[model samples]
Target: MTQTTGTAGDPPYLRIVATIRRRIADGELAPGDRVPSTRQIAAQWGVALATATKALTTLRLEGLVEARPRIGTVVAGSSPAGPAAPTAPTARRRPSPAPDTEPELTLDRIVRASVEIADAEGLAALSMRGVAARLGVAAMSTYRYVPSKEDLVLLMADAAFGEARPADAYADADVPEDWRARVEVGTRTLWGLYRKHPWLARVGSLTRPLLVPNLLVHGEWMLSALDGHGLDPTTLFDIHVLLYSHVHGLAVHLELEADAEAATGQSEDQWMDSRAPVLRELVDSGRFPTFAKVVGSFEDGYDLRLDALFDLGLRALLDGLTPVVEG
Candidate 1:
């Protein structure tokens, strides 16, 4: 087991990297052994997810470890340099000022940097200090453009929502005349955005919605599709929320699955495979005959496809709402 002890002077991530490196050097963790995952590191070291991610990232950059599909990060079979003694903690170094030739910092630049960090790593890995490091600026320098991390995140969400316009999807082609067709176009457009930026699904919810202008563009598109149908105002809005909920509800899992994979070093399939024994035991029990029959009917194991589920759910929902919407 890796010890959590470290000097106060070194950054948390660097201390973690140093500890793991020493383990490799000492053969305590042999080549091909799985490294502790980000979740494990965070829990063991009492640090945030961002710090744990940074530690793993540093180790990967140094050629000390490599990520394997469904297998988590492992010690590199051959490191660039043989494992060496862990260096003692040193004072934290200040980030160098951007050179005279570097681009001037602006609010737009800050938001863009924040979005990039959140996109590449999950939102949990995003930090103001990390953004400053990415831009090669002093950590406090970012505060001038964005008042606080919360404000920066709001700006990031707005910028991300503004990326695609719902109307733009049908711009080149003629807009569909049927209300259902238009609704399909608008809902699918929103789903596409969630796919592009999985972190977006985590931003807001039905109780407290994200009130950004770009997101409103999508709402307007959906409401307008049902405008002339003569449905009551409440019913019209209810239908709109129902459709949005379907997309948002399913899309929320996109980021969650990603985090799960990173934390456990297992893919969805691998995770399900690991649970097969429990499933088999339940099926063998006489208490759930119907459930057993349904499960046993599958020649090949069930594959949970989010895209397929989205399509199926959308079709079913629209079918059920057809009478209410048409009346």
Candidate 2:
């Protein structure tokens, strides 16, 4: 039986690179195929953009892929055309306790260790020094494996995403007859991941997308859903962005609430209770009858009301967008 050990030594980015390299070598990825972008890598790996980029850069240096202008990175023809070589004894091994107590730094070890650090303390706490401390090694030694903090983060993000296998269940679900519902399923799945790791909301920037394979699954699904809608390429891209923004913007609030609850140890209900007296006093002053009426009933609370709001907003947005997409 294989004994499962916790991730205590490896950084996530290197593992991400290794996973992708293995996929390429195993013929899962073919020549000229585009790799995940920096943002996608970050989302998938659950690390910062820096680490995901580093993982990609490592692959590039190893002659696995070439980054092309405009077209993005594509798998290099030089990438091995067969299954990856068997893992060496050292590669299959995990870190063991030592008298000096330092873990051997492999790309896998570095990335896995870094992921554990971020998962526990949050990404803000991740740094070369922090990761090195976890590995019981000098910060400079980590550079031998990851080169820089940025690359390390990129790897972390991609690896996190790679953790979730694409839903094979969706294969039959994406039927031509029910594409809208299919798109919703994909969005909600991603939203659930964000809810699990609320910190994920802060990782991917709206401006600079990190490349990772898992994230593109959502995009690919949405684009395919719009295929029969008769939208132009630009319109399809716009619709995709709009749908993404709707889900992500709402999901971001989940992260904020998580942080707020952690810092205050007070649920939104409790916080509202503390604020109620002052709010009522101001509203009852006869200057804001409208406000008084709105808060007159807190029995349902914001959480209860949020579901209605989501349904209302989604319908309104879709109502307006449906024509444009179908046109």
Q: Which predicted model would earn the best lDDT?
A: 1
lDDT of 1 by residue, 186-296 (tens): 889899888877888999899999988888989999999988888999999999999999999999998899788877778889999999999999999879999999999
TM-score, predicted candidate 2 vs. hidden true structure? 0.59
lDDT of each: 0.78, 0.64
Each model's Cα RMSD: 5.3, 16.6
User: Per-residue lDDT for 313 in model 1?
Assistant: 92
- Per-residue lDDT of candidate 2, residues 73-122 (tens digit): 57997774332333443454332333443456678888886776555334
The 10 consecutive residues of candidate 2 with the worst lDDT sum are: 1-10
- TM-score of each candidate structure, all chains considered together: 0.77, 0.59
Worst 10 residues of 1 by lDDT: 86-95
